[model samples]
Target: MADTAGDSCQNLREESARAVDNAKQLQDSAAAFISRSGTEEQSLRQRALAAESTIRKLRSSLDASVRRGTVDVGVAEKIEEELCKAGSIITDGDVASFLPSIDHGTFLKMFLGPINVRATRKDVQLKVKEEYNRYRDNTSFLFLIFPSALLLLRSWLWNGCFPVLAVQLYQAWLLFLYTSLALRENILRVNGSDIRPWWIYHHYCAMLMALVSLTWEIKGEPNCAHKQKGVQLFLAWAMMQGVAMLLQNRYQRQRLYTRIALGKAKRMDVVWGETAGVEGQLWLLYPILFILQGFEAYIGLSLLKTALVGVVSEWQVIVCGILLVVMAAGNFINTVETLMSKSRFKAKMKRSKSKQELDQGLPPCNSRLK
Candidate 1:
């Protein structure tokens, strides 16, 4: 009996000791976390102060230069170069000049509700960018796979008409998708990402399309096939977009990595709206993209025609159709501009190569024929 009692007391003592040790450890961890957070906050404040100081100094210098009636070209060039470091796709000047109204903050507040989503450090920024790209890739895959499922339901399972609830759910998803995309793009921009304006605007149009689609009446009572035309066309367009997103993610990613390796692209460079093309991919990519744009236009025009011809006159249909047509036109114009720039770049490279070869072919000035 004595031994048993003694054993129980020892066990209790040991457990008490362990509990005390764990409590001490927890207290230490709390202190360390508090210290670490304080340090981080201090660091961030210092950085902000430093940036403000530098900006003030620059402003003073610029003011002085302006008072003298001539700013030094070297100083101006240096400022531009420093600003350009934000991105190859967008000059800081361009971003500053483009939309002075409301700006990124308004959109951020509108979509994400005043959250601080921008990462400050370089490593954090890169990680944010990587995750953003992955988000895009995953969504592209989803769109690709999801639409096929919908197509199957429409054609085989549902007998050529999508369920009303299913259509509503799909439209809701589209709204969420576009809202997420736009929010992320805005955050990325704040983090010094150089995405193009058109890409951001494209998401805006997509969001509008999705919003209007929610109100669109999906029916088969009156005209049967005619009533379902817009939804059918929209599903088809979604499929095309999915395919384009997949190809762009694949080819553009590979090209971006190669360019980074060659030091031809900035580390921060990303594929926004498919400006430059990889070798041998121009033929494969551009044609498909162009075809997709044309098809988008066709869908838009069809919807508009249906409304005009009294096939199905809904305000939702008209609004969605206009948005689609505008988006398609914007995409086509941007693509053509990209192609033209690519052509110019290629021509310049060829001319430079020819010049180099001609120079090499000539005999050295000091070389005498023996």
Candidate 2:
């Protein structure tokens, strides 16, 4: 009986030792797997970057060959499509999970200056844009109030007295606002956000005007009266512009979301202008934008008229007026161009759908009625 009990205890001890050995093996295997995963992650990013460089070079060469008539146009186009697919894979895949997907292009670098504004992750890049949009909305409302209040003080409380201090402070704020907007837009361009170039240029013009406004001399009482008209016109225009901006950001963003859900817009794309693709909102947004543009041009012409009639001949007024007119024209052109492009896109889509239906032996819905 004693021998039997000893043998059973020995067997138990052996089983316990074997269990511990198996656990140790599993721990070692887990450690190896974790190390290998880390190495592969790093390797993946490096390979993707290399691939991107090679692909760019290949594309450049192909473009040059096409331009020189060395490659068949059809073949070149098909190759370009394949290259684009490969590029998209790298951009949208885990390769960029912890790395920057794009550099600030030369265009943005010129505006943003020499610095790396690259974000580490996709979410961070998107958050920067979201913050900029919010900033624009808040500041636009504030700007609207500032000019409105200033004009009221000058007309009622101050009895047409030029509020030099108040006006100059407003100019300073304008400078700061434009500068911040330019910086944010440049950063957005760097982070693969597609911002319209003219919009950024408009801010540049605004910044210049703000600086000029700061330097303008506002003479006391009687001398201020003639120049006051120009200043007042500018103020009114600014107020209208602020309102337009608020409406633009609100409706454009809403339109952007709707299109994204409908698969009409890319996830990375944001609204570029006041003109939205949605019909229900366009009825409300475009008229206001057109009116604002007209008002801007009118103010500019008025300033020019003042200068011509010798009411106010300051270089500042002339420059500001020209800038304003130029901005109005550019905004008008951009809006029209956007509308035309959208129209063409819709027409193309309709044609494609009709062709597909015919190929499938299905008559068009309109044809069914006929």
Candidate 3:
């Protein structure tokens, strides 16, 4: 009993020390930020002070959690996330503009009601998670719904019915999907999720394309001789996206499960479907992804060519085409980099296993005797 009590006390002390260290680091970061801002020095200093105030509140909450003899992992993670974001603002000149908004938001809550500030912060964090899950659920539903709906709609629209309305609906759907994706990506980033920046950038470009498509007129618009062709191409792209999402949702979940089993990922997100896997990627995921990227590029170039030939003179169409090409190039490069990294990692792991077997003076299992 006494040993257990001593160990618990030591753990508490360690946590307290960590909180202190985090506080000191935050102070240093804020000081550096204040020194760096030239004309906006005062405003920057005020924002830093606000961030420091938030850090202190977080430390207090941590202390309370520790004293209660039950640390909330969620709270701890939130604190860490907020600190990282604040630190980034302080150190990264490119993101310094965001500090003002952060400061304003943090201070506004504290000023409105100091006593409930912690509760308010916790509520906000919980809401972020809730909204993210909601977004994912909606995306999965739409991924299935949109392609099927478009496929059916295409039959009617291709014949003599309301082609303008059909085109408008399609564009609207794209806008919704891309906007939601961009918002979700931003939320994930803010929550300190380890999503690739390239993926977020991809969503940004996609959103741009969708926005441009919103203004695209089909029937009555001039230079729209290839409108029907464009519709067919977009429908094909939509169908491909649906299939790609289905495959990705399945294989990525399995990959996450494998990662968790191998002590790679900490845990799987509960929103995904049931998963079963042991090790190594499915290989199928990459081929599907490559195909989707290729399709996107092909459709984009086709649209660009149509625009160049005066079939569509709108700048929005031109810009959208360019963004699609950019996204395709970025996706390809990113995918290739990921594949190479995974291969290298697998090779390293195999070498380590072989070394262990050799150290044990046992022939590799694949060896044959003659």
Per-residue lDDT of candidate 1, residues 182-205 (tens digit): 888777777666677898899999
Better of 1 and 2 by lDDT: 2
lDDT by residue for model 3 over 205-252, one digit each (tens)? 776777777777667333334665665666667777776666556555
What TM-score goes with each of the models? 0.72, 0.73, 0.59
Give the per-residue lDDT of model 2 (tens digit) for 1-370.
9999999999999999999999999999999999998898788777877888999999999999999999987589789988977776666444445345456666466765767787756788778878987897798799799999998988789888667888899999999998888888878776766678888899999899899989987654666777788788888888887877776777778887887576554445667555553777677777888888898899889988888888788888899889889999999999888879878988988986896677579776689899
Tell me the spans in candidate 3 whose CA falls farther than 4 Å from its real position. 1-134, 157-162, 220-225, 267-281, 362-370
**For model 3, what is the alpha-carbon lDDT of residue 76?**
71
- Candidate 2's displacement at residue 122, Å, is 1.4
C-alpha lDDT score of every prediction, in listed order: 0.77, 0.80, 0.62
Q: Which candidate wins on TM-score?
A: 2
Model 3 scores a C-alpha lDDT of: 0.62
**TM-score (C-alpha, index-matched) for candidate 1:** 0.72
Q: Whose TM-score is higher: candidate 1's or candidate 3's?
A: 1
Instruction: Look at candidate 1 and give me any clashing residue pairs.
Output: none
Model 3, residue 304: distance off in Å is 1.1
